[model samples]
Target: MKKMLLIFSFIIFVFNLLTAQEKEKAQPTPANKVLSKYTKEFAVSLLKGVDDSMYPKIFKAKMSMETIRKGRNPIKFVYEVYSKGSTKSLMEIVFPARDKGKKILLLDNNLWMYVPDVSRPIRLSRNQSFMGSTFSNEDVSDSTWEDDYDPEITDEKGDKILLTLKAKRRDVAYKQIDMWVNKETKVPIEGVYYGLSDKPIKKIYFFNVKEIAGLLRPLDMRMADLLEEGAYTDVKLLELKELESVPDYKFDITQLGR
Candidate 1:
């Protein structure tokens, strides 16, 4: 009878141990929690280019883009951008008399470009170049990495963390990205974008850190196409302000005609 009791007790102890192991497995690991926190911070920093807060907000800014190429006069454009969150945005060119009043709208996965004289807005691919610059249409618009990419901490360097991002879906612009983020600030310092073949196609550097709208962020970005020599795009932020509300019509496709 004592042996039988002992055996029963051993079974109970084993069951409890298994139950505890399962519970631990169900909970998020410390590493996963840390990754989540860092990813959120990084997403906030990325969206900070337009708005400082992660909440739903509107922003207006002046974008100055300069493109340099061999044997050609450098091209420059100035645009006024209105953005809502990281999914909707409208950009209107304000400089260079001929291109004035032209607009581009980004609503979720849809992109449209409206020329002043065109009868209707023309659909555009997100992968298309923005006015023949190194910057793609998707680059100028607002987007969040957390929504499109799965991030993992692959390595740790002194004062920096190396993050590898794989696209969660095939429609994303880049198949994968390797980013070096500042450990202290949780801001991306540099990123290398890769195509489906895992070839590096473009590189981006985030610099000119400053406080804008009461938040610290990188105000300048430089993007270079690895396949092209002596060609790159530089985007500078002239102004950024929070808006109380943006009219719903502002994001409508019909509004592009207006």
Candidate 2:
């Protein structure tokens, strides 16, 4: 009887050990949970006007790019933008007769420009200017932070949360970005982009907050170059719409000319 009792006790101990191990596996690690929360918040803040749908969201907008500089007439270009989700977009110059039929395509991380005069689309670097404006190809492209950046909350002030974002891959335009977001609305108020040297190269401000569709988003975005004096670009969204579906071919490079 003593031997049987001892054997039963050993069995119970082993079972308890196994159950504890299973519980540990089921619970998420603290580090991972923290990172996941930051990522979710960053994604929501970055893609403000987008819906939480598996399908891509489409936005149609009239964009006015105005460059503020000294000794040069304030250059303005009007464009019709078609954006799909946070990965693909196409912009066509509409008002300016000289630039009509010119198209800019953002497919994944690649940017291409198709001009009526050029036989084929010219691949553009993310750092390149968008139509000679202060906005870079990367700036105009629609992309989510979760895919390209890893974010962490560095500080929480009264009404804002400061987030530091590091690029997950080298292909990203900016190596690092420091952003201040509204804690209650999850709207990005300001962002500073840093180069590989960890120095700020550009700053962006989000303003004119309003509700479009069901999401609250900033209607105006202004970017200022840190190195350039009195040079900045302001982009205002005249119209925005979310689409139910966008055909995949619209983002294809081959269809850019059409």
Q: How much lDDT does each candidate structure score?
A: 0.76, 0.74
The residue pairs found clashing in candidate 2 are 86-142
Top candidate when judged by TM-score against the true structure: 1
lDDT of 2 by residue, 1-258 (tens): 999999999999999999999977554312212334456566445434122211136767777888887778887888887778777888898868888888888887778898996889999888778776777787777666666677777666787877777788987888877777777777778888876655677899988988775666788889998878888999888877767766887778888777
Cα lDDT tens digits, model 1, 1-258, are 999999999999999999999977554312322344456556444424223322235778887899887788888999998888778888999988889999999888788999977899999887688998888887776666666677777667788877777788887888877777776666668888877666778899888887666666788888998879988899888878778767878889887767
How many clashes in each candidate? 0, 1
What is the alpha-carbon lDDT for the whole of candidate 2? 0.74
**lDDT for position 102 in model 1:** 90
Name the regions of candidate 1 deviating beyond 4 angstroms. 1-56
Alpha-carbon TM-score of each model against the true structure: 0.78, 0.77
Alpha-carbon deviation at 207 in model 1, angstroms: 1.5
Candidate 1 Cα RMSD (Å): 13.1
TM-score, candidate 1, is 0.78
- The count of residue-pair clashes in candidate 2 stands at 1
